[model samples]
Target: MPYEPLPDLATLSLAEIAALNDARKLPPVAQWNPQTSGDSLMTIRADGRWFHDGGEIRRPAMIRAFAGLLRREGDGRYWLVTPVEKQSIKVEDAAFIATDVAAQDGALAFKLNTDEIIVAGPDHPLVARGTAELPAIYLAVRNGCEARINRSTWLQLVELADADLTAASQGVRFALVPA
Candidate 1:
């Protein structure tokens, strides 16, 4: 007997994919798969600034609009997809950076450069990648992308971190959700 594997992606129709991208409230970026037109000369800086054709995109609304369409593929690539086209975009390290952060009730909340607020607590955990002495903080962002914690926010988190963290098992742990 021969064994066959199930196909991925549920085989969504083209029109359905388009409709999904059109609807508001975080379009199904993880689902749609239109043909790749080509790469756009856009690069999202590590500081959460979006640039195109070597010019900084200062319009907050435009950046926010594009940020909504950002997606990460299984092959470790980033793309900005629409109903009809999927354009590749360069990400310096991670897509967005945490511009602001606040703590309340023993949990941390972060505001990303895209103006998306993420409460880093139980549902969306904050994963630390380095020593507590020099930690690289990251918050789970949309579709498997992580937003790096900025310097100021990192400082604040470090100051507020629990003192009982073991040396071997470093990194902040909490959960929040949106992405």
Candidate 2:
């Protein structure tokens, strides 16, 4: 499928963003828990690159397809799940990376490495971690997965923040600096 570019994020209203998110139908991996489980030998590097048996998976379509099947279980494990089986996947850091960001209609819209757009709100909150000197910010994605906010995107958020280093989205205020 051809990837369609979204209209300028800054031009979208909060309701439009919500509607875009609501229209996406993800695979029901949560409902399809099979008894069969095994290692997929797939590793997601800390920088958000996908590799299988030490070989890079270069195709964006394949990566997006595999990303759609990802699930994080109660045991803090990542898996590529299907109705018939589940394959364990190793993740060095976050499963996704927030590659781009925009301040839209009093909300922050994020574009992930997989080209998925999400708005930060109660369901997808921004969390600050790491030390004050080396702060790491993360955004909660679906299925218990998170997207590490990359440096450039983080800077973009900073530019959008108030003097207190906080930003508001969907009536929720988020701290950019780790407490």
Candidate 3:
């Protein structure tokens, strides 16, 4: 049998994506420490564990936050299965997929799917080069603060202060209320 294509979240209108989030059918927001620092550039505790830079929710709490939306199979593993790409990825293991990586502000962002994982190299167009840490940013709108993640530091989280994290991803952003 031929393989079917998954649904692309980016293709949907903002309103449509909002509807999906409203219906609780989308992935839960990842958690980050809001109190750590407000710099866009920061270091993440890549000891194979997620930490909150300073936001409301922290690591373990983040797991609960992502529970249903993104399931944890076993150990400290979580998967994001997207219909559009018909692919699932292990959140912690940043090795399996050869993602196109990029460093913006302080966030080490990856763009991956079934086809490829693009790791943003030094030569990548979006690599942020500087010694001063970027400001710590969060996703905020008329409603309130949404999700938060730390910036990147060679191999750590950069300490950013008073920065806006609205451009974390291309996907529509949403505020996750703890249950």
Best by the lDDT measure: 2
Model 1 accuracy (lDDT, Cα) = 0.68
What lDDT tens digits, residue by residue, belong to model 3 across residues 73-179? 33544333232321122333321221233444333343222221122223221223222343322222111111222333222222221233222334223111111
Over 122-168, each residue of candidate 1 has an lDDT whose tens digit, in order, gives 45567767664566778777777889988887666656655643111
In model 2, where do residues sit more than 4 Å from their true spots? 5-8
Model 1: CA > 4 A from native: 1-24, 130-133, 165-179
Candidate lDDT values, in order: 0.68, 0.90, 0.30
Provide the clashing-pair count of each candidate structure: 7, 0, 52
- How well does candidate 3 match the true structure in TM-score terms? 0.23
lDDT for each residue of candidate 2 in 109-134, tens digit (9 for 90 to 100) = 99899877888999999999997778
Error at 66, model 1, angstroms: 0.6
Q: How far is candidate 1 from the true structure (C-alpha RMSD, Å)?
A: 13.3
Compared to the true structure, candidate 2 yields what TM-score?
0.93
User: Is 2 or 3 the stronger prediction by TM-score?
Assistant: 2
Number of clashing pairs, model 3?
A: 52
